[model samples]
Target: MKKPASAVPAKKRSFMEFMKRREGQRGLVIVLFMAIPLLLLAVFTYIPFLKMVQFSFFDMKYIGDRTFVGLQNYIDVFKRDDIFGALFVSVYYMGGAVVQLALALFFASLMVFKVKGDAFFKGAMFFPYLICGIAVGFIFKFFYARGFVLDSLLQLLGMEMEDIPMWLQDQRINNISLAATSVWRYTGQNMILFLGAMMSVDSDLYEAASLDGANKWHQFRYIILPSIKSIVVLNLILSISGSLSAFEPPYVITNGTMGTGTYFVIMNRLAHENQKVGLACAMAIVLLAIIILCTVAQKLFFKYVFDDGTADESKAAVRRRKMEEKAAKKAAKSGAMAQSSVSGKGGQK
Candidate 1:
């Protein structure tokens, strides 16, 4: 069934007409837009994750004969004290995340108002976040090294050198020191995120609250907190997940010694140094499960805390409601004034 030349033009015209239609254009656009990202996600994220899951079940190295050990790797992940105990180290980081979030919120709130040298302060705060994590690690390593930057500063404050405990050596304070580095590097990032969220809040709400005699604290509590709840939740989940997978500061600063071996550092060591790839994979899976559980738990906690009837509403919805209420009140007051004027005119007559 060969088509003639004229018939081929007719077919081409029909195809062009189809392409001109909205549905065809939409479908074409969707396919074009989604194809690359989906392909990349499959290739990079999903495929690798599935491969890791499969690898968790086998006894293997980076390159070697694989033995089908089934659940032995999983069992060994739990049985090994060194591997499992590393999870406790994450508690320090988690604590640091709390401090980080608090300081971020405080600074963000301050930045929302007019302040002196606002741009300079913001840049100074955010500069750490811009620095390379490895570079920041090395910087702090030297900063915290005995008789270095931090020690020199403390000594200038009339504190004896002997009175100053080793920042990265004393087991009691080394973990805290490492955790503080994480806080230093990340607090600025959290502050910037919080500031963006706060800046997006309706300014009208603040003005109205001010007219209603709401102080800064009251305005922050009732209006800002409610409006930015979603951002707060998002930050909390990310911070918690980051805490669970902390690696850089400890890895670069301390090399995971002095009771500072977090789960990721231990996993790295096992997979690379010890060549326990399967055990490392199992540990990864376990960490993934813990992170998922923590995320779910956090979502549930936030849901419960915000279980007011308006919990499902977004920040925009809250702002819209307030605007509507304000409009309605203004209309009522105008109507009352009109009625009062008519009543006075009637009495005069």
Candidate 2:
């Protein structure tokens, strides 16, 4: 006949009680909200990254017998001249990034003030960034083709046909030409970012600077730059990282030919065309390491440069503090003079 109530009912009752509580409901909601994202991240990002790292250690193709070739792939990454040469090609892109940032900052600084056709100019600049990278690559491909848009424009300036250099074919100028495409495409983006940062700065500070006889250049140097230092640093980091991973311009425009292959393009060829998946994985890992190092170095440099006596204090912070101190001293001096004048009037009375 019916045995004594088992522990199962007791446990079920407790669980139901817990579920009925607000904390339990909140925990359940949290878990439900986090589950999908965490699952997807695990499956897509973490798993793939771990698999790539694993593949880096094995000498195996996408569909081939697996063989462990510990560290040889990594060694080859440095030993191979093509892979190393791709790194050198990145230098041109890095230089282009510097120029891109300068142009972006200059335009952003100018446009932040009242300028005619500012909206149209901003849209014209940022429009390229909104376009697909592949589309941009193709557009520049035709733009750089011999006797194309660029050449036609040059020819209109009384330049002879024989003097015009090949934009994509010549080894000396091809990389520069490709890098210029990147600059043109991305400069607008940086300008927009800098503009956003500049817009956030207090207008009163600008007025104060103007009152102090600061010219446009001085305002830009002492006020705008110090205020937007964070954004400037962020843009620099992104630009440097993008430069290292530049692929679309060189890959689509030149097909990584005539010495335009970047690290990514070379890695892509190694993985797909050559079927050296393991070595490609190693190269990817190496590139990741290099990017991390560069990012850390940049952060440290900014930190050191921006830090004054106080921890993490920026130049803008220092300037603001000095202004506050000066204002306080002026107020205190005025108050003390008023008090002394009142005392003298009382004595005469």
How many clashes (backbone N, Cα, C below 3 Å) per candidate? 0, 0
Best by TM-score: 2
TM values, all candidates: 0.81, 0.83
lDDT per residue (tens digit) for residues 20-133 in model 1: 786778999999999999999999999989988999999999997999899999898888887777888888999999999999999988888778998898889988988987
Q: For candidate 2, give the lDDT of residue 87.
A: 96
Instruction: List ranges where model 2 is wrong by over 4 Å.
Output: 1-20, 306-349
Q: Per-residue error at 278 for model 2, in Å?
A: 0.4
Task: Give the range of the ten consecutive residues with the poorest summed lDDT in model 2.
Answer: 340-349
Worst 10 residues of 1 by lDDT: 340-349
TM-score of 2: 0.83
lDDT of each: 0.84, 0.86
As a TM-score, model 1 comes out at 0.81
